[model samples]
Target: MPHRLHLEQFGPVHALPVLHYRLEFAHLVREAVRRVKPDCIAIELPSTIEAPFLRAVERLPEISVIHYEGRQRRDGAESVYLLVEPADPLVEGARLALERRIPLRLVDVDTDSYPRHVEALPDSYAIHRIGLTPYYEEYRRAAASVAPGREDRRRERGMAWRLQELAKEHGSILFVCGMYHLERIKDDFGRPQAAPLERVRRQGVRLFNLHPDSCREILDEFPFISAVHELRRGPLPPEPDDRGETLRKRFSAFELIVGGRKDLPAEELLRHAVERGARHAGRGEEFPDRQRIIFRLFQEAARHYRQETGDPVHLWQKRAFFRFARNYALASGALLPDLFQLLMAARGCVDDNFAYALWRLATFYHWQRAEADIPTISISPEEIWGGSRRIRFRPRERRRKGLSHLGFLKRKKEKRPGEWLEGFTDPSICSYPPEDVLIEEYGRFLKKKGAMQLSEELSRTEPFTSSLLDGIDLRETLRNVADGRVYVRESQRAKGGVGSVVVIFDEDRENGNYPYRTTWLGEHEQESDMAFYATPPEDNIVGPGICRCEYGGFLLSYPPRRMMDVWRDPDYVFARSKPEVLLLAALDYSPEKHVVHVAARPPRSIFRQIAARMGKKIVHIPLGSLSSVKLKSIRVLHILHGHDKRQVAKDYIW
Candidate 1:
């Protein structure tokens, strides 16, 4: 594929020992140069490719030479990295030009002085993305609600423009760049703007490239799917007709699934459902949908609602749906060969919502598949891979009683009969404990001890809520944001696992909402941040000022009754280390705690007494072994594995 000018080959380059293959490539290049014996020998690649190009190009320096390269990221971090990598391609090409004593021309985009923007200083040509942020957000979404494939077409014309720009400045002997990019380079936006080869010929400038057979090894090796892209894709296609009443029927099916009653129209219902979703988030609460709610969304957007179940009501769902869908399609291409093929067949058959859903499912299949690590064929040869699916959805079941329990409660509220709103109609209207109302009415309630406010002696807490503090100190500020009562300073940062609930539903595992993801609390959000992360109220054993942290599922906190105070009032141990008993007592039920293990080397009687105060016991054994400790009602068996670790395995008992 070399240009028709006298061809030359340069050989025996690189640090590798003069092996047969190494010498062969050098010999090939040397011969290509010898035939061309014209003024200058121009090689390809940037200056940093290797020293061989420098040596060869210099050998025939009667001709001028040049090197070429591309650009990468533009931020400060990437700048330092570029210094080491030298991302240019004209090294060997320029070295040959210099060695042949020929003239040289170097060409490429430069972002040395300014930050790289999508459309700024594009070396590949004038073509580029108009905006940056939207492009960045494209990959964040799991679905391809937007056109996810236009990036490849954009890269092509940009390169052509850059080359032409370079050609205008230099003489008839300008070499564009690497063969791969040059091959795909289009003179215009692929809309039949004259071909690159035609233009290069008009200028009387020759072009060169590599053959397909020569580069087959590399083409066969790498996978071409876009992973973690920073691209701005074009807009999405218009939605097609859903085939007679098929779309209507499918929408109805989803409506029936989420809402027990199927009478309501889909669009209006979706708005109101979103309103409910908003209300939950406004209070910083996770929206736990009733089964009725679930069935409604499923009926409307069956595939979509399934994934939206666990994500926050924020923009994450909409964004993730597209990204996940695209990735799934790419990874599942081999498994679901008909994916894009089927997509292309029907052409405009899918809507943004359902299309995003399908695409999201296909994308996430990588981790979801049992054998993600195993590569398989994505598109099959036999698959015609076109035409749209008329996936009519039908609800598996429906709830018979929608708020039947609230019927009498609405009657008791004494509203005009026709205007009555039942309990299920709205949950926020339901009554709170007397203390909440009292606090709202009388401020923080205090026992009027000797006509003095003793409210400071007690406090209340809500899950993930902090107590009200005025002119706060360290104790109240950190709260559940971190662990313990370690003194903190101004501008201190504390972050912990934020979203924790045992709510059961769909989309929990897939979206990373469950198991867990770390949400943050910086030194900002002030008192409210602490209040929301650690809402402390009165009457909890999490005693005085602030106490134990109710983080995630368990409490890593001290006994509410202070060690000093509880020591004076030993009966208080029931509220401190024994919250299990304390909670049962709150519910008027009694549970037992067993001192299951007696240490093999029993502690001193005085130590035993102190440990016993915290619900432990000590016992003696002759040998170092601890098989002697037996128990009843103990679920966690902690056997001593050695020092500092435990062999915690389930101990089955008869």
Candidate 2:
């Protein structure tokens, strides 16, 4: 429920002060109109531009701008523009008056040379937690310290004179004006006032439709939030309380008879789910929550990000983004973050692809169009806000264009269905050469890292008497500062070198995600013998003979062509999962006394005991210690039917 403020009243007139072009103020205006039910509605715009402004407001949900020429000065004449948007309180009040058939009054005095006034105010989102009464009282206290200029005083007196005239005919009146001029208008209403010298009528005033692309740069509130407000303004059905109620409401007897026992279509199910989510998010409340709207925006952007780049946004990234955004808002003295802060946080926490996705979603307004019923005009950020901050978003693909350019290309698809399946007729299959080189390089790096960890475990430190064995250990020397003695360290090498490396990307214990398994020996001396389990190739065919797959776990052993198919090996029958089987094969086929294992967790203790019985050791390396970017690059593998297909595979891979 909205908290009603004690507005200033004189006779039958009530004055409500508001800030211009704010969504929270618009909601307050809506609530006030419903509660007051006044016969006449008064706004702060002048009578000269009333006709064109009302016509622009009639095109609700579509934005417009009023253009005119100001008075001539010693230098030249200036162009003036007034934006008419759904998020502005003045626009909403005018729209309500027209919709409810109430008498509308435009009561401000117009002057061609009115100077622009700018003031710093707190973020309006605070009204959600703090009531509007307290918010208005605080604004009143702060605004009382500033004095009014000549034109401001004159306009306030003129509006007071109009309200006095309106009070005689109408039984009740609601006057909506700016916070800066409200106090002066209320004081002048009690005393007799005269009409000030101002422009009674203007010539050559025109209204134009705002271009859809320009909405992002000029609007005070973001396009997505404004659209949310518009959606809540219409009639809405009663929201279900739980899942059972929602199912009962959606699955009716008519639907069952018409669909004949089949499930709902995917698009219909998705729409219903979205509608339920919106209602559960409190869109039916008296005032919509800005934080909830921001949360939904991020979720929608993440979905688009996943569809565009084959990558999932992690939960940790989302937490970090909100933390960063909160601190950014605090630094700017705001209770909540704006669109610019959200974009910056997204780019800092994730990558450019996610930030680009967020930008596209934030600027989308469904009702906006390039072709409208009026003359459309394109404007820039400099024209409205006087300045803007720039950010560059470059995706993974390289192009010749600069930072200001944006272009999108359609992904290539098969000309006909089942055309790619025909390329799989060949009996033989081989791995792509480039992917093999990358995996082998990563394996060597893991082996080197494991050796260093083993060496550190064997080294010892002691006090130096005459000669140092290896070198002085600075860390130990610092610890013995009280004794005033130097510490020396001795290093010993491990007994054997690492010969096999096993990398586990995912331990699929349920045995459903990755089902494909294969074993292949190297064709040349440079490659290692490989065995792996991965996603099915038939699900993602990219080209005539090429298919892409992600590795679940893999084994790489040097000296190719010596190992048999490990997936069917009877010796490793005790293994529980595909990752365990790969670990056992690594211990069995390794030529040296040491093997490297990399995964999210260390292997079972039984594997260590089995290696000890065979006079070998398992060196565990945590998978998170490696670079995620490098790991992601090596996890993707492409298979080809024949060597001739390698020449055209580059065109199909991203």
Candidate 3:
């Protein structure tokens, strides 16, 4: 009973106004057709290219383009293209008519010289919330101010004439046209209309299958959302009721169908995801909610990203992504973010690997293929949209030759399986020299930071009489502005410098994730003796002797060889978790008065008491305060089986 279903009815003709090539409008067209059940369907396409256009539509989920040479002008002859996509309302109407065996009409004037009109219209997504009738009314009010050109008027009259001619035979006709021309066409229909000048037929109009890659750049709706619409058009699997018996019955059938296929189609996977999302949201699956669809898309993309990079996308990153995307869409005057904004958000919130994963998933259309019965043509964003924006995605893993031009390079791989693992024969393992230097530098930086923090904690502020102890305390002076008295701060330096730094990347309370625990003595005075627990090195062999691992928690003590193997020593047996053990070792081994502790949360109160007993102050610095990018860069450590393996490690490492 929505106003959209009851369009502008004029006797036998019911005209439906739509924003061409929009997913919401396409849904509205399908709903309108089901409700109206008209005998004939009329669309605002030129009769000249009707054959090629219809043929393209018949291809359905596989997208196609109607290409033809336009009329020559003073500038030159230009090429015209009509994309036949499931998201297009006109194409949907024609498809419905053909499927129902109803008469189809392409009634626009056949002039190849129609000037392309670009209007700053509201996003079509608004229709989903406000209803199509209100959306169209607002658009019509704004468009009334801009008068149509002579050619537009001629086309309107020509379509009106064709509708009148068709009305003689068909009892009911459904007219689907762009909102811009609907009013003029209705006006011409009320009055007696004459056939305007137009070509009777177009020659050399051909249909071509759209190359799959081109769908990312040229499709009106991105492929992911388009595929959702296409999936909804077919018969959907039955949903479960409260009794649950029906679900069990249907699931068996579903499993049977899935068991037969070697590889499940992408659409089928998307369908399952959509249904699961809808069930979780307590919403009906009658229409696809764009917001939920995008959420599922991100989840799927994140899954792929984790599979490819072995790094999971955190919940905080997902929250940041949606927040950024929402703000970007608002800045662009859109209710929802487009493909570009989504990609930007993904890249900004996470990393290039995740962005690449999202782009790959968004551009995938199951039915599109390089080889087709019809001619396959590739197009670029520049050709279809006049201009384009660029985003660089430097994925960790290299791609094949076709994508090498897009900033992807071939990565080094072992010539044979288990070849890299053969280099692990040496008994002794040592840290890569460059990684040692990086960690040593970071330890020094942490020592300095801890000393500064300790100094701040011991600083005192008092009323200034004559001599300022250190400097005027601007904050304290401002607080006593009413008294007109100045305050000076006297900073006290710690008795001894920091000697040990403990950084906990993961608490590992269950002691499960990081299984490789070791204590290594430094080779010289420059490197700190270290104790750390990390992922098992044998799991990821980057080179023959070089294995990559991530740190869980680590303790660094200065004065090189003074520290013993803390992981094995029974002195720290009272510690509960891996991080606690490291903290205990740092407090015990630090010769200086202060020890630096970096982690997501402060160490337990018992650790502070233990540090106090050991005559050392624990300086707790939040892990989040530092740059995550820098932390990630330093987290990865490469272990070489022998010191000599460092010579060839660089070639295998990224």
lDDT by residue for model 3 (320-340), tens: 999999999999899899999
Tens digits of per-residue lDDT for model 1, 1-654:
022122111121111101111111232233344444434323332223334334333322111112222234464232111100001224333445654566653322222223322321111100012222232233224222433234333444444454454444433333423322333442242333322221121111111121222111111111001100100011222332222221121122222234322333333333333333223321122112222222222233443333332111123333443344345445643212233432232122222334443333222211112122222112212221123244332222222376544232222211222221111122111111221233222211111110121123233233323432333354554665565433322232122111111111112223322222111121222110001111121111111111111111111111112112211234435432222222212122101121111111332355345435644322222222211111111111111112211111111100
What is candidate 1's TM-score against the reference?
A: 0.18
Off by over 4 Å in 1: 1-327, 333-386, 390-590, 594-654
lDDT score for candidate 2 against the true structure: 0.80
State, as a TM-score between 0 and 1, how close model 3 is to the true structure.
Answer: 0.81
Alpha-carbon local distance difference test for all models: 0.25, 0.80, 0.81
Give a tens-digit lDDT track for model 2, residues 107-155. Answer: 9999876778888787888777786678778988998989889889889
Give the runs in model 3 whose Cα sits over 4 Å from its true position. 1-6, 235-284, 394-422, 451-496, 507-512, 562-576, 601-615, 642-644
After aligning candidate 2 to the native by TM-score, how far in Å is the CA of 162 from where it should be?
2.4
